[model samples]
Target: LPKTSNREAQKIVLRIKRKCRETESEEVAVSIGIGVATKTEPEQSIDQVLKEADNEMYQNKLSESRSTKSKIVQSLLNTLTAKSNETKEHAVRMTKLAFDFGEKLGLSNSQQHRLSLLATLHDIGKTTIPEEILKKPGKLTDKEWEIIKDHPERGYKIASSSQEFAVVADDIYAHHERWDGSGYPGKLKGENIPYLARIISIIDAYDVMTHDRPYKNAISKEEALAEIEKCAGSQFDPELAEKFIKMMSA
Candidate 1:
Protein backbone atom coordinates (compact mmCIF):
# COMPACT_ATOMS: atom_id res chain seq x y z
CA LEU A 1 0.00 0.00 0.00
CA PRO A 2 1.32 3.44 -1.00
CA LYS A 3 -0.38 5.12 1.92
CA THR A 4 -2.75 3.73 4.50
CA SER A 5 -4.20 4.34 7.92
CA ASN A 6 -4.00 1.75 10.65
CA ARG A 7 -6.62 -0.22 8.71
CA GLU A 8 -5.47 0.32 5.12
CA ALA A 9 -3.90 -2.44 2.99
CA GLN A 10 -2.14 -2.92 -0.34
CA LYS A 11 -0.47 -5.77 -2.23
CA ILE A 12 3.17 -5.48 -3.26
CA VAL A 13 4.82 -7.81 -5.85
CA LEU A 14 8.34 -8.60 -6.99
CA ARG A 15 9.49 -10.03 -10.38
CA ILE A 16 12.65 -11.68 -11.62
CA LYS A 17 13.77 -11.70 -15.25
CA ARG A 18 16.28 -13.98 -16.85
CA LYS A 19 19.33 -12.75 -18.68
CA CYS A 20 21.40 -15.36 -20.48
CA ARG A 21 23.22 -15.59 -23.80
CA GLU A 22 21.24 -18.80 -24.41
CA THR A 23 18.11 -16.75 -25.13
CA GLU A 24 19.65 -13.37 -25.88
CA SER A 25 22.87 -11.72 -24.94
CA GLU A 26 20.75 -8.80 -23.84
CA GLU A 27 17.90 -10.82 -22.39
CA VAL A 28 16.82 -14.38 -21.75
CA ALA A 29 13.27 -15.72 -21.59
CA VAL A 30 12.77 -17.48 -18.26
CA SER A 31 9.70 -18.82 -16.56
CA ILE A 32 8.59 -16.67 -13.65
CA GLY A 33 6.13 -16.74 -10.79
CA ILE A 34 4.55 -14.09 -8.58
CA GLY A 35 6.85 -12.17 -6.22
CA VAL A 36 6.41 -12.18 -2.45
CA ALA A 37 6.56 -9.45 0.23
CA THR A 38 9.51 -11.20 1.96
CA LYS A 39 9.92 -7.99 4.02
CA THR A 40 7.30 -6.06 6.00
CA GLU A 41 7.54 -3.54 8.86
CA PRO A 42 6.54 -5.07 12.16
CA GLU A 43 5.12 -1.67 13.05
CA GLN A 44 2.33 -2.25 10.58
CA SER A 45 -0.68 -3.60 12.39
CA ILE A 46 -1.91 -7.11 11.68
CA ASP A 47 -5.15 -5.70 10.27
CA GLN A 48 -3.35 -3.68 7.58
CA VAL A 49 -1.27 -6.63 6.42
CA LEU A 50 -4.31 -8.87 6.11
CA LYS A 51 -6.05 -6.32 3.92
CA GLU A 52 -3.11 -5.78 1.57
CA ALA A 53 -1.99 -9.37 0.96
CA ASP A 54 -5.29 -10.58 -0.49
CA ASN A 55 -5.06 -8.11 -3.30
CA GLU A 56 -1.40 -8.74 -4.07
CA MET A 57 -2.04 -12.35 -5.05
CA TYR A 58 -4.77 -11.57 -7.55
CA GLN A 59 -2.52 -9.26 -9.46
CA ASN A 60 0.23 -11.86 -9.26
CA LYS A 61 -1.82 -14.42 -11.22
CA LEU A 62 -2.92 -11.80 -13.70
CA SER A 63 0.64 -10.65 -14.32
CA GLU A 64 2.05 -14.22 -14.39
CA SER A 65 -0.53 -15.53 -16.90
CA ARG A 66 0.65 -13.03 -19.46
CA SER A 67 3.00 -15.84 -20.45
CA THR A 68 4.68 -18.91 -19.00
CA LYS A 69 7.09 -15.99 -18.86
CA SER A 70 4.55 -13.61 -17.41
CA LYS A 71 4.62 -9.84 -17.19
CA ILE A 72 4.57 -10.58 -13.49
CA VAL A 73 8.13 -11.85 -13.82
CA GLN A 74 8.92 -8.85 -15.92
CA SER A 75 7.17 -6.73 -13.35
CA LEU A 76 9.09 -8.24 -10.46
CA LEU A 77 12.41 -7.77 -12.16
CA ASN A 78 11.28 -4.32 -13.11
CA THR A 79 10.24 -3.69 -9.55
CA LEU A 80 13.55 -4.90 -8.25
CA THR A 81 15.35 -2.71 -10.75
CA ALA A 82 12.96 0.06 -11.68
CA LYS A 83 10.54 0.54 -8.81
CA SER A 84 13.37 1.63 -6.59
CA ASN A 85 13.97 4.48 -8.98
CA GLU A 86 10.30 5.30 -9.12
CA THR A 87 9.76 4.90 -5.41
CA LYS A 88 12.63 6.50 -3.46
CA GLU A 89 15.40 6.80 -6.03
CA HIS A 90 16.32 3.16 -5.33
CA ALA A 91 16.59 0.66 -2.49
CA VAL A 92 20.29 1.34 -2.97
CA ARG A 93 19.80 4.73 -1.40
CA MET A 94 18.43 3.12 1.73
CA THR A 95 21.15 0.48 1.52
CA LYS A 96 23.86 3.11 1.55
CA LEU A 97 22.08 4.76 4.40
CA ALA A 98 22.21 1.47 6.30
CA PHE A 99 25.94 1.18 5.69
CA ASP A 100 26.51 4.77 6.72
CA PHE A 101 24.66 4.09 9.91
CA GLY A 102 26.89 1.07 10.43
CA GLU A 103 29.99 3.19 9.99
CA LYS A 104 28.73 5.79 12.43
CA LEU A 105 28.15 3.02 14.93
CA GLY A 106 31.73 1.76 14.45
CA LEU A 107 30.78 -1.52 12.79
CA SER A 108 33.30 -3.33 10.57
CA ASN A 109 33.14 -3.43 6.77
CA SER A 110 31.85 -7.01 6.74
CA GLN A 111 29.23 -6.07 9.26
CA GLN A 112 28.32 -3.02 7.18
CA HIS A 113 27.97 -5.25 4.13
CA ARG A 114 25.69 -7.55 6.07
CA LEU A 115 23.60 -4.58 7.23
CA SER A 116 23.37 -3.42 3.64
CA LEU A 117 22.18 -6.84 2.50
CA LEU A 118 19.60 -7.00 5.24
CA ALA A 119 18.40 -3.53 4.34
CA THR A 120 18.08 -4.45 0.68
CA LEU A 121 16.19 -7.73 0.95
CA HIS A 122 14.51 -7.33 4.29
CA ASP A 123 11.04 -7.83 2.80
CA ILE A 124 11.97 -11.10 1.08
CA GLY A 125 9.61 -13.11 3.26
CA LYS A 126 6.63 -11.56 1.52
CA THR A 127 7.43 -13.88 -1.39
CA THR A 128 6.13 -16.87 0.55
CA ILE A 129 2.74 -15.28 1.12
CA PRO A 130 0.10 -16.12 -1.49
CA GLU A 131 -0.57 -13.20 -3.84
CA GLU A 132 -4.28 -13.58 -3.10
CA ILE A 133 -3.70 -12.54 0.46
CA LEU A 134 -1.25 -9.81 -0.48
CA LYS A 135 -3.60 -7.86 -2.74
CA LYS A 136 -6.74 -7.92 -0.68
CA PRO A 137 -8.02 -4.46 0.40
CA GLY A 138 -10.80 -5.26 2.82
CA LYS A 139 -10.21 -6.18 6.39
CA LEU A 140 -8.78 -9.68 6.60
CA THR A 141 -10.38 -12.45 8.54
CA ASP A 142 -8.44 -13.83 11.48
CA LYS A 143 -7.43 -16.86 9.42
CA GLU A 144 -5.87 -14.65 6.76
CA TRP A 145 -3.90 -12.66 9.32
CA GLU A 146 -2.46 -15.92 10.55
CA ILE A 147 -1.03 -16.56 7.09
CA ILE A 148 0.42 -13.05 6.89
CA LYS A 149 2.20 -13.43 10.23
CA ASP A 150 3.77 -16.68 9.08
CA HIS A 151 5.86 -14.89 6.45
CA PRO A 152 8.88 -14.46 8.76
CA GLU A 153 8.90 -18.18 9.45
CA ARG A 154 8.26 -19.03 5.81
CA GLY A 155 10.93 -16.62 4.61
CA TYR A 156 13.36 -18.05 7.14
CA LYS A 157 12.56 -21.48 5.74
CA ILE A 158 13.14 -20.28 2.19
CA ALA A 159 16.46 -18.68 3.05
CA SER A 160 17.63 -21.69 5.05
CA SER A 161 16.51 -23.97 2.24
CA SER A 162 18.76 -22.10 -0.10
CA GLN A 163 22.44 -22.91 0.42
CA GLU A 164 23.58 -19.43 -0.52
CA PHE A 165 21.91 -17.31 2.19
CA ALA A 166 22.12 -19.68 5.13
CA VAL A 167 24.65 -17.38 6.75
CA VAL A 168 22.14 -14.56 7.16
CA ALA A 169 18.86 -16.46 7.39
CA ASP A 170 18.68 -16.05 11.12
CA ASP A 171 19.20 -12.30 10.88
CA ILE A 172 16.58 -11.89 8.17
CA TYR A 173 14.15 -14.00 10.14
CA ALA A 174 14.48 -11.90 13.26
CA HIS A 175 14.97 -8.34 11.94
CA HIS A 176 11.59 -7.51 13.39
CA GLU A 177 12.62 -8.19 16.96
CA ARG A 178 12.68 -4.97 19.03
CA TRP A 179 15.35 -3.62 21.33
CA ASP A 180 13.04 -3.78 24.32
CA GLY A 181 12.47 -7.46 23.66
CA SER A 182 8.90 -6.76 22.54
CA GLY A 183 9.37 -8.05 19.00
CA TYR A 184 8.16 -11.24 17.35
CA PRO A 185 9.68 -14.67 16.67
CA GLY A 186 11.95 -14.45 19.75
CA LYS A 187 11.32 -11.33 21.85
CA LEU A 188 15.07 -10.89 22.21
CA LYS A 189 16.30 -7.66 23.84
CA GLY A 190 19.26 -5.23 23.64
CA GLU A 191 22.56 -6.77 22.71
CA ASN A 192 20.93 -10.17 22.86
CA ILE A 193 19.59 -9.39 19.39
CA PRO A 194 21.95 -9.73 16.44
CA TYR A 195 23.67 -6.42 15.74
CA LEU A 196 23.16 -6.49 11.98
CA ALA A 197 19.49 -7.29 12.37
CA ARG A 198 19.09 -4.48 14.85
CA ILE A 199 20.81 -2.04 12.54
CA ILE A 200 18.67 -3.09 9.60
CA SER A 201 15.53 -2.77 11.68
CA ILE A 202 16.35 0.80 12.72
CA ILE A 203 17.07 1.92 9.19
CA ASP A 204 14.09 0.01 7.89
CA ALA A 205 11.80 1.83 10.27
CA TYR A 206 13.33 5.15 9.29
CA ASP A 207 12.77 4.45 5.61
CA VAL A 208 9.19 3.30 6.12
CA MET A 209 8.29 6.34 8.12
CA THR A 210 9.97 8.85 5.84
CA HIS A 211 8.69 7.48 2.55
CA ASP A 212 5.28 7.29 0.99
CA ARG A 213 3.98 3.75 0.40
CA PRO A 214 0.80 2.43 -1.12
CA TYR A 215 -0.75 1.97 2.31
CA LYS A 216 0.49 5.01 4.22
CA ASN A 217 1.26 8.62 3.65
CA ALA A 218 4.79 9.80 4.08
CA ILE A 219 5.58 11.54 7.32
CA SER A 220 7.83 14.58 7.29
CA LYS A 221 11.48 13.94 8.02
CA GLU A 222 11.07 15.76 11.29
CA GLU A 223 8.13 13.60 12.22
CA ALA A 224 9.96 10.49 11.15
CA LEU A 225 12.98 11.54 13.13
CA ALA A 226 10.87 12.24 16.16
CA GLU A 227 9.18 8.90 15.86
CA ILE A 228 12.52 7.15 15.89
CA GLU A 229 13.76 9.29 18.73
CA LYS A 230 10.67 8.47 20.73
CA CYS A 231 11.07 4.78 20.08
CA ALA A 232 14.63 4.78 21.29
CA GLY A 233 15.04 2.16 23.99
CA SER A 234 11.53 0.99 23.24
CA GLN A 235 11.24 -0.02 19.59
CA PHE A 236 14.74 1.06 18.54
CA ASP A 237 18.26 0.54 19.83
CA PRO A 238 19.16 3.74 21.67
CA GLU A 239 22.85 3.95 20.86
CA LEU A 240 22.33 2.77 17.30
CA ALA A 241 19.48 5.15 16.72
CA GLU A 242 21.58 7.99 18.01
CA LYS A 243 24.34 7.24 15.54
CA PHE A 244 21.87 6.76 12.70
CA ILE A 245 20.04 10.00 13.40
CA LYS A 246 23.30 11.91 13.47
CA MET A 247 24.24 10.37 10.12
CA MET A 248 20.90 11.29 8.58
CA SER A 249 21.18 14.88 9.81
CA ALA A 250 24.58 15.14 8.20
Candidate 2:
Protein backbone atom coordinates (compact mmCIF):
# COMPACT_ATOMS: atom_id res chain seq x y z
CA LEU A 1 0.00 0.00 0.00
CA PRO A 2 2.83 2.39 0.84
CA LYS A 3 5.73 2.88 -1.54
CA THR A 4 9.39 3.60 -0.82
CA SER A 5 9.23 5.61 -4.03
CA ASN A 6 6.91 8.15 -2.36
CA ARG A 7 9.37 8.44 0.50
CA GLU A 8 12.70 7.76 -1.26
CA ALA A 9 11.83 8.00 -4.97
CA GLN A 10 12.11 4.22 -5.70
CA LYS A 11 11.09 1.76 -8.41
CA ILE A 12 7.75 -0.02 -8.01
CA VAL A 13 6.75 -3.59 -7.11
CA LEU A 14 3.62 -5.59 -6.19
CA ARG A 15 4.32 -8.79 -4.28
CA ILE A 16 1.24 -11.03 -4.07
CA LYS A 17 0.77 -14.16 -2.03
CA ARG A 18 -2.51 -16.01 -1.64
CA LYS A 19 -3.86 -19.33 -0.53
CA CYS A 20 -4.51 -21.27 -3.72
CA ARG A 21 -5.60 -24.67 -4.89
CA GLU A 22 -3.01 -26.37 -7.01
CA THR A 23 -5.49 -29.09 -7.85
CA GLU A 24 -9.06 -29.86 -6.96
CA SER A 25 -9.34 -30.26 -3.19
CA GLU A 26 -5.62 -29.61 -2.89
CA GLU A 27 -4.93 -26.39 -1.00
CA VAL A 28 -1.43 -25.01 -1.39
CA ALA A 29 0.33 -21.87 -0.26
CA VAL A 30 0.53 -19.46 -3.16
CA SER A 31 2.93 -16.60 -2.73
CA ILE A 32 3.17 -13.48 -4.81
CA GLY A 33 6.04 -11.10 -4.06
CA ILE A 34 5.96 -7.47 -5.17
CA GLY A 35 8.21 -4.59 -4.15
CA VAL A 36 8.97 -0.92 -4.75
CA ALA A 37 12.45 0.37 -4.19
CA THR A 38 14.34 3.57 -4.97
CA LYS A 39 17.06 3.26 -7.60
CA THR A 40 19.37 4.84 -5.04
CA GLU A 41 18.16 2.81 -2.08
CA PRO A 42 20.94 0.81 -0.47
CA GLU A 43 18.74 -1.97 0.90
CA GLN A 44 15.16 -3.02 1.60
CA SER A 45 13.73 -1.22 4.62
CA ILE A 46 11.54 -2.85 7.27
CA ASP A 47 8.43 -1.06 5.97
CA GLN A 48 9.15 -1.93 2.33
CA VAL A 49 9.94 -5.51 3.31
CA LEU A 50 6.71 -5.80 5.28
CA LYS A 51 4.74 -4.12 2.49
CA GLU A 52 5.95 -6.89 0.18
CA ALA A 53 4.38 -9.36 2.59
CA ASP A 54 0.76 -8.34 1.87
CA ASN A 55 0.53 -10.78 -1.07
CA GLU A 56 -1.09 -13.22 1.33
CA MET A 57 -3.63 -10.62 2.41
CA TYR A 58 -5.65 -10.68 -0.82
CA GLN A 59 -5.80 -14.43 -1.45
CA ASN A 60 -6.92 -13.92 -5.05
CA LYS A 61 -4.24 -14.92 -7.51
CA LEU A 62 -3.86 -17.94 -9.72
CA SER A 63 -0.56 -19.27 -11.09
CA GLU A 64 -0.63 -19.29 -14.85
CA SER A 65 2.08 -20.35 -17.21
CA ARG A 66 1.33 -17.37 -19.39
CA SER A 67 0.10 -13.88 -18.74
CA THR A 68 -3.40 -13.41 -17.38
CA LYS A 69 -4.68 -12.20 -20.72
CA SER A 70 -4.01 -14.80 -23.39
CA LYS A 71 -5.81 -15.20 -26.72
CA ILE A 72 -4.16 -18.57 -27.16
CA VAL A 73 -6.55 -21.30 -26.05
CA GLN A 74 -3.86 -23.75 -25.08
CA SER A 75 -1.39 -21.57 -23.19
CA LEU A 76 -2.25 -23.20 -19.89
CA LEU A 77 -1.73 -26.68 -21.27
CA ASN A 78 1.43 -25.61 -23.10
CA THR A 79 2.95 -24.49 -19.81
CA LEU A 80 2.25 -27.84 -18.21
CA THR A 81 3.57 -29.80 -21.17
CA ALA A 82 7.18 -28.69 -20.98
CA LYS A 83 9.53 -26.97 -18.55
CA SER A 84 10.03 -23.56 -20.12
CA ASN A 85 8.61 -20.93 -22.45
CA GLU A 86 10.83 -22.32 -25.18
CA THR A 87 8.79 -25.49 -25.01
CA LYS A 88 5.61 -23.45 -25.38
CA GLU A 89 6.88 -21.86 -28.58
CA HIS A 90 7.99 -25.22 -29.84
CA ALA A 91 4.46 -26.51 -29.40
CA VAL A 92 2.99 -23.46 -31.11
CA ARG A 93 5.35 -23.81 -34.05
CA MET A 94 4.47 -27.44 -34.35
CA THR A 95 0.79 -26.51 -34.45
CA LYS A 96 1.53 -24.07 -37.24
CA LEU A 97 3.60 -26.65 -39.03
CA ALA A 98 0.81 -29.18 -38.70
CA PHE A 99 -1.77 -26.80 -40.09
CA ASP A 100 0.48 -25.82 -42.98
CA PHE A 101 1.17 -29.45 -43.69
CA GLY A 102 -2.57 -30.12 -43.73
CA GLU A 103 -3.10 -27.25 -46.12
CA LYS A 104 -0.49 -28.65 -48.45
CA LEU A 105 -2.21 -32.01 -48.31
CA GLY A 106 -5.42 -30.41 -49.68
CA LEU A 107 -7.30 -30.62 -46.42
CA SER A 108 -10.32 -28.36 -46.29
CA ASN A 109 -10.03 -25.01 -44.50
CA SER A 110 -12.29 -26.18 -41.69
CA GLN A 111 -10.29 -29.36 -41.25
CA GLN A 112 -7.05 -27.41 -41.10
CA HIS A 113 -8.59 -25.04 -38.61
CA ARG A 114 -9.69 -27.78 -36.26
CA LEU A 115 -6.41 -29.61 -36.81
CA SER A 116 -4.47 -26.59 -35.62
CA LEU A 117 -6.59 -26.36 -32.52
CA LEU A 118 -6.14 -30.03 -31.74
CA ALA A 119 -2.42 -29.87 -32.43
CA THR A 120 -2.02 -26.89 -30.13
CA LEU A 121 -3.59 -28.78 -27.27
CA HIS A 122 -2.34 -32.26 -28.10
CA ASP A 123 -0.22 -32.51 -24.99
CA ILE A 124 -2.76 -31.08 -22.60
CA GLY A 125 -2.75 -34.38 -20.78
CA LYS A 126 0.79 -33.60 -19.73
CA THR A 127 -0.77 -31.51 -17.00
CA THR A 128 -1.63 -34.67 -15.13
CA ILE A 129 1.98 -35.83 -15.14
CA PRO A 130 4.14 -35.12 -12.12
CA GLU A 131 6.61 -32.27 -12.52
CA GLU A 132 9.53 -34.63 -11.95
CA ILE A 133 8.39 -36.88 -14.78
CA LEU A 134 7.70 -33.97 -17.12
CA LYS A 135 11.05 -32.35 -16.32
CA LYS A 136 13.17 -35.47 -16.29
CA PRO A 137 16.55 -34.79 -17.89
CA GLY A 138 17.43 -38.32 -18.94
CA LYS A 139 16.06 -41.05 -21.10
CA LEU A 140 12.69 -42.25 -19.86
CA THR A 141 12.50 -45.84 -18.81
CA ASP A 142 10.05 -48.21 -20.45
CA LYS A 143 7.70 -47.71 -17.55
CA GLU A 144 7.90 -43.97 -17.99
CA TRP A 145 7.20 -44.30 -21.66
CA GLU A 146 4.16 -46.30 -20.75
CA ILE A 147 2.95 -43.46 -18.59
CA ILE A 148 3.77 -40.81 -21.15
CA LYS A 149 2.04 -42.69 -23.92
CA ASP A 150 -1.22 -42.51 -22.01
CA HIS A 151 -1.34 -38.75 -22.48
CA PRO A 152 -3.12 -38.86 -25.83
CA GLU A 153 -5.95 -40.71 -24.18
CA ARG A 154 -5.92 -38.56 -21.09
CA GLY A 155 -5.88 -35.44 -23.24
CA TYR A 156 -8.90 -36.76 -25.05
CA LYS A 157 -10.87 -37.13 -21.87
CA ILE A 158 -9.80 -33.78 -20.47
CA ALA A 159 -10.59 -31.90 -23.67
CA SER A 160 -13.82 -33.74 -24.26
CA SER A 161 -15.05 -32.85 -20.83
CA SER A 162 -14.67 -29.19 -21.63
CA GLN A 163 -17.81 -29.44 -23.83
CA GLU A 164 -16.73 -26.42 -25.85
CA PHE A 165 -13.90 -28.45 -27.38
CA ALA A 166 -15.53 -31.81 -27.77
CA VAL A 167 -14.76 -32.12 -31.44
CA VAL A 168 -11.01 -31.94 -30.99
CA ALA A 169 -11.15 -34.59 -28.33
CA ASP A 170 -11.05 -37.35 -30.93
CA ASP A 171 -8.08 -35.72 -32.58
CA ILE A 172 -6.18 -35.68 -29.29
CA TYR A 173 -6.80 -39.37 -28.91
CA ALA A 174 -5.74 -40.20 -32.46
CA HIS A 175 -2.68 -37.98 -32.82
CA HIS A 176 -0.33 -40.62 -31.54
CA GLU A 177 -1.59 -43.33 -33.89
CA ARG A 178 0.67 -44.11 -36.84
CA TRP A 179 -0.44 -44.92 -40.39
CA ASP A 180 0.98 -48.40 -40.24
CA GLY A 181 -1.05 -49.29 -37.15
CA SER A 182 2.01 -49.05 -34.95
CA GLY A 183 0.55 -46.31 -32.77
CA TYR A 184 -1.01 -46.45 -29.33
CA PRO A 185 -4.41 -46.13 -27.61
CA GLY A 186 -6.17 -48.19 -30.26
CA LYS A 187 -4.00 -47.89 -33.32
CA LEU A 188 -6.36 -47.06 -36.18
CA LYS A 189 -3.84 -46.76 -38.97
CA GLY A 190 -4.02 -44.74 -42.18
CA GLU A 191 -7.26 -42.86 -42.85
CA ASN A 192 -8.75 -44.47 -39.83
CA ILE A 193 -6.72 -42.11 -37.67
CA PRO A 194 -8.63 -38.85 -38.13
CA TYR A 195 -7.10 -36.93 -41.05
CA LEU A 196 -6.27 -33.89 -38.96
CA ALA A 197 -4.76 -36.07 -36.31
CA ARG A 198 -2.62 -37.69 -38.94
CA ILE A 199 -1.60 -34.29 -40.24
CA ILE A 200 -0.55 -33.15 -36.76
CA SER A 201 1.33 -36.38 -36.09
CA ILE A 202 3.72 -35.79 -38.99
CA ILE A 203 4.49 -32.21 -38.05
CA ASP A 204 4.59 -33.01 -34.36
CA ALA A 205 7.28 -35.60 -34.96
CA TYR A 206 9.25 -33.16 -37.07
CA ASP A 207 9.13 -30.41 -34.44
CA VAL A 208 9.93 -32.80 -31.61
CA MET A 209 12.91 -34.03 -33.57
CA THR A 210 14.22 -30.54 -34.26
CA HIS A 211 13.75 -29.19 -30.73
CA ASP A 212 15.85 -29.96 -27.71
CA ARG A 213 13.81 -31.77 -25.06
CA PRO A 214 14.48 -33.09 -21.62
CA TYR A 215 16.44 -36.00 -23.02
CA LYS A 216 17.67 -34.71 -26.36
CA ASN A 217 19.42 -31.77 -27.92
CA ALA A 218 17.93 -30.10 -30.95
CA ILE A 219 19.08 -31.24 -34.34
CA SER A 220 19.14 -29.08 -37.48
CA LYS A 221 15.99 -28.62 -39.55
CA GLU A 222 17.66 -30.47 -42.41
CA GLU A 223 18.65 -33.36 -40.17
CA ALA A 224 15.22 -33.51 -38.56
CA LEU A 225 13.54 -33.54 -41.97
CA ALA A 226 15.88 -36.31 -42.94
CA GLU A 227 14.72 -38.34 -39.98
CA ILE A 228 11.13 -37.72 -41.02
CA GLU A 229 11.95 -39.00 -44.47
CA LYS A 230 13.69 -42.00 -43.00
CA CYS A 231 10.75 -42.91 -40.80
CA ALA A 232 8.05 -42.26 -43.37
CA GLY A 233 6.68 -45.75 -43.64
CA SER A 234 7.15 -46.64 -39.97
CA GLN A 235 6.75 -43.63 -37.69
CA PHE A 236 4.67 -41.44 -39.99
CA ASP A 237 2.24 -41.77 -42.83
CA PRO A 238 4.14 -41.76 -46.09
CA GLU A 239 1.58 -39.46 -47.78
CA LEU A 240 1.55 -37.00 -44.88
CA ALA A 241 5.32 -37.22 -44.70
CA GLU A 242 5.70 -36.28 -48.36
CA LYS A 243 3.27 -33.40 -47.98
CA PHE A 244 4.94 -32.08 -44.83
CA ILE A 245 8.37 -32.21 -46.41
CA LYS A 246 7.08 -30.38 -49.41
CA MET A 247 5.49 -27.77 -47.15
CA MET A 248 8.72 -27.30 -45.22
CA SER A 249 10.67 -27.11 -48.45
CA ALA A 250 8.33 -24.43 -49.70
TM-score of each: 0.61, 0.67
Q: Name model 2 segments beyond 4 Å from true.
A: 1-84
Lowest-scoring 10 consecutive residues by lDDT in candidate 2? 9-18
Clashes found in each candidate (C-alpha, N, C closer than 3 A): 42, 11
Whole-model lDDT values for every prediction: 0.64, 0.69
Off by over 4 Å in 1: 1-90, 132-145
For residues 1-66, what per-residue lDDT tens digits would candidate 2 score against the true structure?
443454442222221222222321212223333334233355767666555544532333333322
